[model samples]
Target: MEVNRFESINEGTILLIDKPYGWTSFDVVGKLRSLIKKYTGDKSTKIGHAGTLDPLATGLLVICTGKATKRVVDLTADSKEYIAKIKLGETTPSFDLETKIDATYPFDHVNRELVETVLKTFTGSQMQEPPAFSAKYVNGKRAYEYARKGVDPKLEPVPIEIQSIELVGFDLPSLVIKILCSKGTYIRALARDIGKALNTGAHLVELRRTRSGVFSIEQALSIAEVEKKLSNMCNQS
Candidate 1:
């Protein structure tokens, strides 16, 4: 069922937001919390996001407010879809552009056919290691903390499913792909593995979450739009 935007603060509702790049998932929640408090004068209203998207990525973010926050676990369990661009011939410790390139390789041997075949190998359940610069907790500290200190935490691999991988576009060194995968699947890790398979190092240059479960970017509102709506609501009250 679609939620009514004009519902009372105590009435739960789900919000689909087009999270802007450079903004963390927690940043969205914080902004919305302030808006709700200003509009409804309810400082204690609960607001949470279903999943976490990296600050460097943009797109659909499922935000739950009021009683709807209770379903966050169920919402996060759904499959996710993403469109990413990987740059061949180079790799970074963080797997994405968040970190500087640590090494380079020759991409002369990489081609369209080779990429298609390599993607096929990843279209099933497999064990994947999360990136070192990730939110994964280790001994109560974030994995990135250990990575920043030059400590290799040696995170264990976990099972993940890649439902589908479609090659959207491919140039010699840059490849664009659309992926549908189960929860916990990391595109950064996939980029790294693809490079390894091609005998050329690679890393993610860009990434966007297009869908999460039943929510799609098409139905999501931008931060500015949400803020404007909340402002109007405040005036109406």
Candidate 2:
């Protein structure tokens, strides 16, 4: 059945966007809002994203528009899947490449067997502390804001579930793994913990969200693609 763009958008629509690197989740929302306004001529259309992806990470970002905004909670609550590349022998305040290396350790003892064993320990429910440089609010300010000013915020460990972790590639100093975790799980923190388990330090180098609930990267559209689609819809209108 052919759907009318205005009617569909006004009612509700879930947009699966492939968020580009270096762009905050809010950037995607703002860009889409502009395109939507241009297309529908409605400036007050509701739009929001289900989850926030760090500027360093990229992949499927579930964006809900119009009445679909109500589904943001449900969408964010779903299991998330990610492929991460963690660099061992180094630690960073941000737990990822977003920050400079603060410390380093000998990773010579790390091997495939050790990696597998350490990953096993992270399976199931556990309390994990978020990175100091995270969006987590602290004292009415974002944690990252404190981190930027050379201040450490006291962040409590939150309970999270790790459904599974599979070693995709294992090379000395670099471990590529695929993870399926519950909402609120931080891959950067996981990387830091994994390094600790091995008696070494580690930090996330590359991370991508391959899936969120039923939405996969395969179903996501780039910002440009979305813009074009909206433009076409506007022309049709």
- Return the top candidate by TM-score: 1
What is the clash count for each candidate, in the order shown? 0, 0
Write candidate 1's Cα lDDT for 1-237 as tens digits: 584364654578999999999999999999988878877778898988998999999999999888899999999999999999999999999999999999999999988999999999999899999999999999999999999999987888999999999999998799999999999988999999999999999999999999999888898998788878887887776
lDDT per residue for candidate 2 within 5-66, as digits (tens), equals 33477568888889999999999999988888888788998989998899999998998888
TM-scores, each model vs. reference: 0.97, 0.95
Give candidate 2 regions above 4 Å deviation: 1-7
Backbone clashes in model 1: 0
Error of 1 at 125 (Å): 0.9
State candidate 2's TM-score: 0.95
Number of the predicted model whose lDDT against the real structure is largest:
1
What residue pairs are clashing in model 2?
none
